[model samples]
Target chain A: MAELTDTAQQRATGLLRDYGAAVRAKRIRAAMYFVALVICVLAASWSGEVDLRKFVEGLPRFGSYFRDITPTLRPATLGSDIAEWYWNFPVWLELLLETLLVAYVGTLAGATLGFFLCFFTSANISGNRTVSFVVKRALEFCRTVPDIVFALLFVFAIGLGPVPGVLAIAIHTAGALGKQFAEVIENIDLKPVEGLRSTGANWVDQIQFAVLPQVTSNFASYVLLRFEINVRGATVMGFVGAGGIGKELLGSIRQFYYSDVSAILLMIIATVVVIDLLTERLRHRLLGTAKV
Target chain B: MKPRIAEPCDIDRLRTAYPSAFAPGYARRAAALAGISAVVGLFIFGVVWLGFSPSALVQGISKLGVILKLMFPPTAGQHMLVYLQALAQTLSIALLGTMLAALVAFPLSFLAARNVVGRWLLRFLTKRVFDAIRGIDTLVWALIFINVVGLGPFAGILAVAMSDVGAFGKLFSEAIETASPKPVEGVLSTGASKIQEVRFAIVPQVLPLLLSQVLYYFESNIRSATVIGIVGAGGIGLYLSNEIGQQSWDHVSFIILMILITVAIIDAVSGRLRRSIIGAQARS
Candidate 1:
């Protein structure tokens, strides 16, 4: 009994020593990371030209910029003041509509393309390994180049219009959605697929009957999410002179038309918020009833 | 379980009794058809409204091919050093912006979390604020910052930081809310203050997740930081746009390649880091 107690104490001491060493090692690792973080922060500040004095001085200007963007309104002429502030309302509205259309068309086209590509890309569906590998890399290239950069290229290629905007958004969307759709396809129950195969169903038929039903709702949800992102992307497409209210917004900002800038900004924010809410509802509805 | 049909007569009776289930009701089929038609109709309308023509697409593709041909034999020309500097600045902007955003978001996220903030109204308002900030594009923020602070990478950093704050706040708050409550209760049972309880329990649980998210954003922000310069916010983008303006295809391709390589490298590194950190937390 005495020997047993002695061994127990020895083991306890050994365990505590090991724990202490581990704790010390963890502390050292944490300290090193902290030091690295500090170094990076300082280096970033230096390279980014983050001057404290400039920032402090700019603070008041920042407040003023916001203040300046706010239209002066009295209780008496609030309605007219609002109207006057949004003087280019008709033009901006038309552009906003165009932007929405661009996003819509882009999403539809992209989702359609992704729908086809995902079958080819999905590991369980695609039998051709080389084809899948090549297509996967192609999709990566499409998405890796940011949509705006694509817009810039398209604008150069196709001449400036909403068409380039649509194409850019579509390509990026296809790349992004294809990857997601492939993931969804990869995760579907394979039993249905196996059963279809046993019945001598062709590859295309199997995909259509077994795979499409399982992934459609998920694909729709993802497409809607892409639409939301594309809308935001479309807003900035005009920055590259592709088309939309962004060009107007940029022009106003550059020419220092503060109120117009604010007006357009407000319209954009409102549109995004409304779209976000609508899509959130749609996504919930789709996902909530997905079991069906 | 239903009673097994032992005869053809019973099958006939079941089919008559559950005709709608056996063949989906007309209304349900009609609804599905209508939904598909509506989607198709919308696509057609959008195509027409956007003036999307197959011929135009073909023309554009050919034009793009010509331009892509010009992009071959990618070269930096005389501006390699300048381009390198700009790239570094973009990296700096992304890093600093992510750090600042993380700092601002870390505490504010607590106020937005349902479990941390008792008041529903406050939490709702906080979330809305995050949404509003996030709704605005990063470029718009860059434009605003440029106007206020004048043009430079500073504006780019501010823009990235501003946009990321909203994103980080939302994600961090969600992370905090999802944290297991057992640790919180254990800490509370020790008669610890609320702050102490949070410090000892919640932070440790969510920190790994939050850090991983922050790292992921940092990787993407590098890409954004590259673009903000097109609007005079400062970075490689200004040079890129300038090169494009001059139709310097070789330089354009070189710069694009650089951006791609940088993005790929960051993605890999951040992915490894996130996995390691999360893995460590899981083990602990």
Candidate 2:
């Protein structure tokens, strides 16, 4: 090995020191992040009033509530009958069905409205810039307000029932789906639209012949997803006296009908799971067709 | 053969040969028309049943007018600080919930991840557990926690955390599973322990994604926390609902405006934050 000159050795030492400094800087940065996190956590705990001592003491109570909600028939009454476990299944089932119908109808109506508006709103597809702006603003307004809030107003306007729930869900869906649908439309292959336009097709004809074919599957998928959300929203809307399983749920909670609350919750959960499975399968089928 | 413009007869012959090029099928048209009509029919059915009569609508509009007129002077009223405190509490609930859930989910995701859990049975069971947790709504959890915690933001925080834990379990596990194994193998080749490998390889890969997701959820949880508050868990929602219940439309309007502004601001900030963080990660 060649002998290192004095200057070369000095340079090497300087480079090593610089590298160490860089490493130290990184460590300091990481430490600062940790410190910030801790500070925020402390602040959050203070503001949230989350007393750990109380939480530890209350933990058992939490478990006991769950335990209490669990249905326990007397040993003498024990049997294989499902009805014994879910005494209010028939009434709950009807309310759940109504909730489903609310979602289905709301989604259908919203999707139709959204499908029209999205084409106009898409930046790429310009019929009139002014019209698109107004539609976009309207959709933004619709979506910005939470669905439950709308349900509350509708309850005031139309009186209590699933009708308010439907109206609320539909308006909210129109806003949300319109934005997504417009994005999908904007991202589509514009060549097809251009081709239709070159064939002397009008705006409607162009969208019908070109854009619709490409976007329909995606539109359907979004609608299906919205329907799922609307189902949940419908349930919540009922809490506001808009009508559905939520009304009974609220009543049960208020009356401390612990077993009924658990039973109703279970039914809702089961319905959601089944819908999730169905939608997953349906989405796959639609996407598979889209590829072809 | 001389080139010539196609006559109408020639065009008709071509159209007959390639019908799809010209006319949509009668069946398809009919199906579309039928579908639209059915949707309209159902909407009308619901509308009619809901008593959306023209006169009823006019009457309702007049009633709404009265509320609107009252709501015009959007003042914070006497309890501005109370409203502000409630808003702060809501933000804290969302922040703490998101952070706590992220902390809990980070470890449990390994159990749920198909790539990490060697046994199919363990992974399947873990996923189902996650699913069950997620199947329960945040409001439902809030109600449960309300009875246990005896109201206030503590219950709201727990409710948000519980729901997010379920969501983050699925999301984090998916993130873990999608990570390229090459870096992990490289770490293993260096005679590193399992924990070291995870730290050197997996953590580096997924931490950015985890952070980004937590940030995104923080924004959404703010809104969700408000909803939970409506159930008396505690927040601006409780305040807003009370105002509405008491027919204090001005305060309700003010609170609503605050919510809208807060949400919009958070959305914009999160977008920027994500872009910067992801960009930094990409460069590194």
Candidate 3:
């Protein structure tokens, strides 16, 4: 009995020691992480000139800017106040329409290009490994460079117009959508594809008969999502003189037309909300029907 | 919408039972045709309205080619130091901005999460607020901040932080909502208070996922920081815009190359960090 108790006590002590070592190691790691985080924060704040005092001082100005942008209204002249707030309603509407059209055209063109490119990029269908690898990298380059930067480049090359805006959005959209489409294609069940191949169907026929049916609805949904993003992008394309409501917004901002700035922002926000709702509904409908 | 069972050797019965399968209805066919026509019509109309002609495209491509040629020999000109410093500043902006946003968002996300916040109206309001703020792009925020706080990287930081607050809030709340209830129950069984339960249970469960998300956002915000600089909020983007204006294609290419490299490096590093965090969590 004495020998057995000694062995049990020794085992208990060993287990406790191991536990203590594990916990101490964990604490050290945590401490190191904390130190590293503090260092990064201090260095970043210093380099970025993140002065809390300056921000606090400017806080009032930020508040007042918001205040100034809010359109004043009284019960007596509400209609006139509203009308005056949106004084350039017609021109703004025209520009807004152009922005929508730019998004539409950009999305369509991008989706079409992405549709073709995705097949070549997808690992399952890519006939040539080198081509797939190159296409993937190109898509990454396109998406990594912000659409606005692309607009800046296009605006430089093509001159100021909606065309540059369209091209910029299209290129970015293709990159973004192509990756998504390729992923969808890669995830597809390959049994049908194999069956088609075994039946002596050519590559094109296999894709058409087996792959397209599985991925069309998904592709459409992705295209709609891209369109929503591109609309927001197109709104800002005008800042670079690529043509859109953004040009007007930028002008008002630079000239300090506070009311006009607020008015245009509201219109843009409303348009985005509406488009979001509409596209969401369309996507649901498409996916739901596809399932049925 | 139920599938119809057709009697074998009864073609007439099958046709009557599933008429739409044999021949689409007039209304359906017309609607389909109209949809196709509308799409084609809009494409043509957009082509004309946007002046997207083949001739113009060919001309623009040649101009782009010329610009590309100018960009081939990438050089930083005389302002290499300035460009490098600006690059560092961009990274700082993204890092600081993301940290600040995550700090601000941590508490707010609990208020937005359904499992944490019992009140439906509060959750709804919080979500809508997030949506509204997120709807405004980071550059727009940068422009506004420049007006309010004056030009420089400070504005860029504030703008990035402000925009990311919305995104982080939404994402963090979703992460919180998905945390398992078992942990909360276990914590409660120990007679822990509400705050204690959350601190000891929910947070631990969700922290790894949230950190991974924050890391991902940090990587993307670096990209955004570069763009926001073009609006004069401060960073290498300011350098880029200046060079572009001066028609210094080589310098512009160099700055762009720097951005791409920085972004790629950060992406790889952050991805590793996120994987490690997730792996540690799984092991635990």
Model 1, docking class: medium
**lDDT tens readout by residue for model 2, A1-292:** 3456877888999999999998999899889978988998898899999989878977999898889888886766677335666887889998988877777777877877888889889999967999999999899877877888777777776778887787788898999999999999999999999998998999999999999888999988888888777776777678888777888888887678988988888888788778878888888898888988
Q: Model 1 off-target regions past 4 Å?
A: A1-19, B1-18, B53-55
Cα lDDT tens digits for candidate 1, A61-82? 9999989999988899999999
Using lDDT as the yardstick, the better of models 1 and 3 is 1
State which docking tier applies to candidate 2. medium
Query: lDDT by residue for model 1 over B1-284, one digit each (tens)?
Result: 77674576677788889887688578988999999999899878888887878898899999999999999999998989999999999999999999999999999999999988899999999999998889889999999999889999999999999999999999999999999999999999999998998899999899899999999999989988989999999889999889888999999999999999998998998899999999999998
- TM-score of candidate 2 to 2 decimals: 0.89
TM-scores for all predictions = 0.94, 0.89, 0.91
Pairs clashing within candidate 3: none
Q: Which window of 10 residues has the lowest lDDT sum in candidate 1 chain A? A: A137-146
**Where's the lowest-lDDT run of ten residues in candidate 2 chain B?**
B48-57
- A166-229, model 3: which lDDT tens digit per residue? 9998898889999999999999999999999999999999999999999999999999999888
For residue B121, model 2's alpha carbon misses the true position, in angstroms, by: 1.9
Q: Pick the candidate with the highest lDDT.
A: 1
The C-alpha lDDT values of all candidates are: 0.92, 0.84, 0.91
Instruction: DockQ each candidate and list the results.
Output: 0.75, 0.50, 0.61
Pitting candidate 1 against candidate 2, the one with the higher TM-score is 1
